[model samples]
Target chain A: MTRIACRQLAPRIGDLPFNRELSAAAIRDAAGADVIVLPELVTSGYMFASPAEAAAVAVRPDHPLFAEWAAAAGDAVVIGGFCERGDDGLLYNSAAVVDRGGVRAVYRKTHLWDAEKSVFTPGDRPPPVVRTSAGPIGVLICYDLEFPEMTRLLALGGAHLIAAPVNWPLVERPPGERPPETVIAMAAARVNRTFIACCDRAGTERGQEWTLGTAIISPDGQVLAEAGEGAQATADVDLLLARSKALNSRNDVLADRRPDLYSPLLHRRAPS
Target chain B: MTRIACRQLAPRIGDLPFNRELSAAAIRDAAGADVIVLPELVTSGYMFASPAEAAAVAVRPDHPLFAEWAAAAGDAVVIGGFCERGDDGLLYNSAAVVDRGGVRAVYRKTHLWDAEKSVFTPGDRPPPVVRTSAGPIGVLICYDLEFPEMTRLLALGGAHLIAAPVNWPLVERPPGERPPETVIAMAAARVNRTFIACCDRAGTERGQEWTLGTAIISPDGQVLAEAGEGAQATADVDLLLARSKALNSRNDVLADRRPDLYSPLLHRRAPS
Candidate 1:
């Protein structure tokens, strides 16, 4: 069994020093877990007024904070989001996959959310599936989870588990229903037959409340653990179970795909 | 506003004459609805013992049954499934879109489910989005909804509503939870910002039970109506609402797709 833990922390806006310690502490607390996840923009809180404000807290991948997180993680793999300062001097909404050694992979957020278009540049490359001590872990940022193609690609790339760091802004939903983003994640997990851990941030930032819908979904699309008015959600699951996409004797989800008929999805324009 | 109705009628296995009257009666009962949906293989029930058993009731597009359905439909559009006899003498699991004007389009199930592979030929063509009096309606059959690419492609093809004919086999799920298939449909609707009406069959055939999870979902991914121990589920919705994929000022669901980075999904082989 692989233990997965998600920390739903509240980051102070533009306060990198405070968040750095908070994230490291969370990682240390869940050090025994095989995988630990933190919310998107946990290092620099979301709801920035301008690009300059976001850039103020942005850090490069080599920043010492990752090393701290690595040290705290021990044998576990940690996936958490940050405001990134790219080599090209542009800002990006990025997530880093770190183990005891160091930063293993960095994936920039491809599909930016509502106000993020003005604050960060969208990523050009696809998210990575890093081979970790726990298993193969795929990484995706907040809004990227909404795109089915993104999850499909990661699953096809042989990811046993997908760690998503999302800051889902509060939206109106019917009473007793889960957040829409969580529903999307559940569907993605079931269709791909892959485990998914979505870490959502807590607390309101600049009058914007969050859904706070952190969840750890099993391969069968069941919510094994959910952070309900809590700072953490954890679950112990057989991650290897996700490696088999078969639903029954004859039906394997990944093997059943008809890619040749999917070329229409490659077109950029919406039908008129 | 479009009045969408789904009739969850149970078909007798290998009894086409009985099912033909059953479906036509249901369509006539909901003739006032703008769109009416029926379960997959409603004409020839699921659980065929052999390919010959399925082919015994397979139909062509020009079958008189469709004309009967058109007559019963009045001004409404009807979308339902059947075992199809192709020109090449192969059998397919297919759905037909019909109206007072007769058959608008026929879409064969591209993704066949368990046991279906042994009885039907997989479709080479993509599902079609047909322009109807109600709105632009896309078609999918049974297991096809599980494939995110199928839904994504249909939504991208300017479908305001996806009319699906599904025969969901009963599967194990946690108590008090909706069927997994319904969950998948909800997620697909939300991500694509398109309304979906899934018509599921009822009753047991050959000792095989059904999920009976027929649901009509809004663009926001909320269930507008569900068939609960009943033969019908109906909802009044503005189909045009799905045309705008905008969630907020800067985020439009369809416009946010990064197709350039999705080439990996076109590959058929699983990663080793």
Candidate 2:
């Protein structure tokens, strides 16, 4: 069994020094787990008013902040979101995969959420499935999880678990229902037959209340653990169960894909 | 507003005459609804013992059975599944869309489920988004809902509502959880910003129990209505809500798609 933990922490906007320590502490707190996840923009809180404000807290991949996470991670592989300052001088909403060896992979968020388009340049490349000590872990930022193609891509790339760093802004839902984003995640997990750990931020930031809907979902699309009036959601999961996409003797999820008929998805459709 | 009704009927296997009347009666019973959906293979039933057994009950698009449904349908558009005998002599698991105008479109199940592979030839063409009096309604059959690509394709094709005809076999699920198939449909509905009505068969056939998980979901991914201990799941939904893909002013679900990065979905990946 692989132990996965998600720390739902509140990051102070434009406060790098404070966030750096808070994230590192969260990682240390979850040190025993095989995989640890923190919410999106853990190093720099969301709701940026301008590009300059976002750039103020943006850090390069080589920044010492990752090394701090690596030091605290112990043997666990830590995945967390950050404000990224790329070599080309553009800011990106990105996530970094850090293990004991330091930064292993960095994935820029390709699908930016509302108002993010004004502050960050969308990543050109697809999300990465980084091979880790626990397993091959796929990385996706908040809005990316809403895209079924993104999850399907990662699953096809042989990812056993997908660690998503999301800062889900509060949305209205019917009473007794889970957050819409969580529902989307559950569907993605079941269809791909892959485990998913979504780490969502907590606390209200600039009047934008977070959903605080961190969840660790199993391959069967069950919520093994969830952050409910708590700071962490953790689960011990058999990551190897995701290695086989078969649901029964005759049906394998990945093998049953009809890719030849999916060409329409490659082109954008005109608005209805 | 569209009054969608899903009739969860029990079809007796290998008894086409009985099933034909049962489905026509179901359509007539749901005549007041704007859109009526029926279970997959409602005309032939599932769990065939052999290809010959399936072939015995297979039908073509021009079969008089659909005319019976159309005659009883009134103004409502009806979508239901059947065992299809193709003109080329191959058998297919397919769904037909009918209205007062007769058969509008036929979509073969592209993703065949477990045990279905043994008796039916897989559909080469993509599922159809048939333009109807109610709106453009997409059709999917059984396991086809498990494939995110199929739903995404129909949503892109300007479908306001997706009508799925499913014969969901009973599967183990964690207590207090909805069926996994329903979860997948909810996710597909939300991500695509489209409404979905899944009509699932009820009762056991050949000792194969059904999930009886028929559901009507809104664009927001909430369960508008579900078949609990009842024979039908009905919901009065604003289909126009799905026409505007916008969640907010800045986020349009369909516009946010990064189709350029979705090329990976067009090719099959080696099994993990």
In terms of lDDT, the poorest run of 10 residues in model 2 chain A is A263-272
User: Interface RMSD values for the candidates, listed in order?
Assistant: 1.5, 1.9
Q: Is the docking of candidate 2 incorrect, acceptable, medium or high quality?
A: medium
- Give model 2 RMSD, 1 decimal: 1.4
Query: For candidate 1, lDDT tens digit of each residue in A51-105?
Result: 9999999999999999999999999999999999999999999999999889999
Each candidate's fnat, listed in order, reads 0.73, 0.63
Off by over 4 Å in 2: B228-230
Residue A28's lDDT within candidate 1 is 90
Model 2 residue A18 CA deviation in Å: 0.8
CA shift of B30, model 2, Å: 1.2
lDDT of each: 0.92, 0.90
Kindly list the per-residue Cα lDDT of model 1 for residues B1-272, writing each as its tens digit: 99999999999898899989999999999967999999999999999999999999999999999999999999999999999999999999999999988999999998899889899999999899999999899999978999998888899898999999999989999987778999999999999999999999998899999998899999999999988643789999999999999989999888888787886554645854
